[model samples]
Target: MLSGRFRLLRREEPERANAAIGLDIEVFDAWTGQARAAGTLSGGEGFCAALALALGLSETVQAHAGARRIDTLLIDEGFGSLDEEALEMAMEVLAGLEAGNRLVGVISHVAELKARIPARLEVTPGLRGSTARFVIA
Candidate 1:
């Protein structure tokens, strides 16, 4: 499940980690094919792995007997470190979820990500504290 989901979310990553052991996942370099602890992953890599795990878990829950189907998911932060290609991959996965009638809300401050997202709720620090603005398209 983890391997398939990771590939769906990160096609560029060719080699997907085996995450059956919870937080003790082992990641392999796509080119080198060398495996290492998940902790060795860079910020962007970690974020992608975490997102894949969340998505896989969501699917598992929805598929479980007598479990209610989940319709919404909210991810806060973690986009800033991802390079353009990786971010695009993540966005593609989220778009798939949206297409399936699921609501995927991403809370991020990265300008690039913000520009790509069609609708967003932005929060900015202000003199009083913070202010939020909702944007559509």
Candidate 2:
């Protein structure tokens, strides 16, 4: 998921924390060229880093493959951690991807994200199970 300072990693090693699905990663360290506790990151920084990495990896794969051909990118809830500036930056990145055919899906409970990113699927929990409704707005 694209996040700024959400719990992307374990408490002890935040910098090393990664999405379980394995995407490209780029993190902005407060202390350059060094490692620190994962909890130390401000929300925006962490999310920016992760998003950058993911984007970079996608670019690399497309370059080698000679075409853009990823079916979709699904991100679970994690965007709320960012500040306004960070949120804008993240949105900018998402927006720029529109030129390609890849479908980028971000799953978030944060209302701001729901409003900012168009084309979404909402999941609601019920007594027996959960139901999802797809929306393109």
Candidate 3:
């Protein structure tokens, strides 16, 4: 699953090296096809990779938890840097989680995300104080 997701984000398979000391990951650029250290990935690319890994871990946990699969996932501001196409891809992946009866909560200020999400909890701050309202579309 991680491999497939890496391909989705990078258009190529991710290469990993297991040194005696630790693990090293190389993520290739989608356009240039040049590999770089995972730590060197841009914010969006790193988010994609981290999201893939997290989703995989969630799946594993659910599978092993028997009758107690995780029911909720909260993503906060992880969509800040994704472009349109990457946003669409990420949304598709997140939608799958909801389809499986999990509650996916995304906390983002991105306008495009607000349009796409069916439900939201909006927070507002004024000189007086702060307020929050939940809306479902």
- For residues 10-103, write the lDDT of model 2, one tens digit per residue: 2333334563523222333433654445446566565666676577677789789979676677666558888777778777777767656667
Instruction: Give candidate 2 regions above 4 Å deviation.
Output: 1-40, 66-68
Candidate 1 runs further than 4 Å off = 1-22
For model 1, how does the per-residue alpha-carbon lDDT over 82-102 read when each residue is reduced to its tens digit?
Answer: 887788888888999999999
Per-model TM against the reference = 0.77, 0.65, 0.75
Model 2 Cα RMSD, Å? 7.2
Arrange candidates by TM-score, highest first: which order? 1, 3, 2
Q: For candidate 2, which ten residues in a row score worst on lDDT?
A: 5-14
TM-score of candidate 3 on Cα atoms, chains taken together: 0.75
lDDT of 2 at 66: 79
Best candidate (score: lDDT): 1
Number of clashing residue pairs, candidate 2: 6
Q: After best superposition, candidate 1 residue 61: deviation in angstroms? A: 1.1
The CA root-mean-square deviation of candidate 3, after full C-alpha superposition on the true structure, stands at 5.2
Q: Go through the candidates in order and give each one's C-alpha lDDT.
A: 0.76, 0.64, 0.75
TM-score comparison, 2 vs 3, better candidate: 3
Candidate 3 C-alpha error for residue 128, in Å: 2.1
Clashing pairs in 1: none
Task: Rank by lDDT, highest first.
Answer: 1, 3, 2
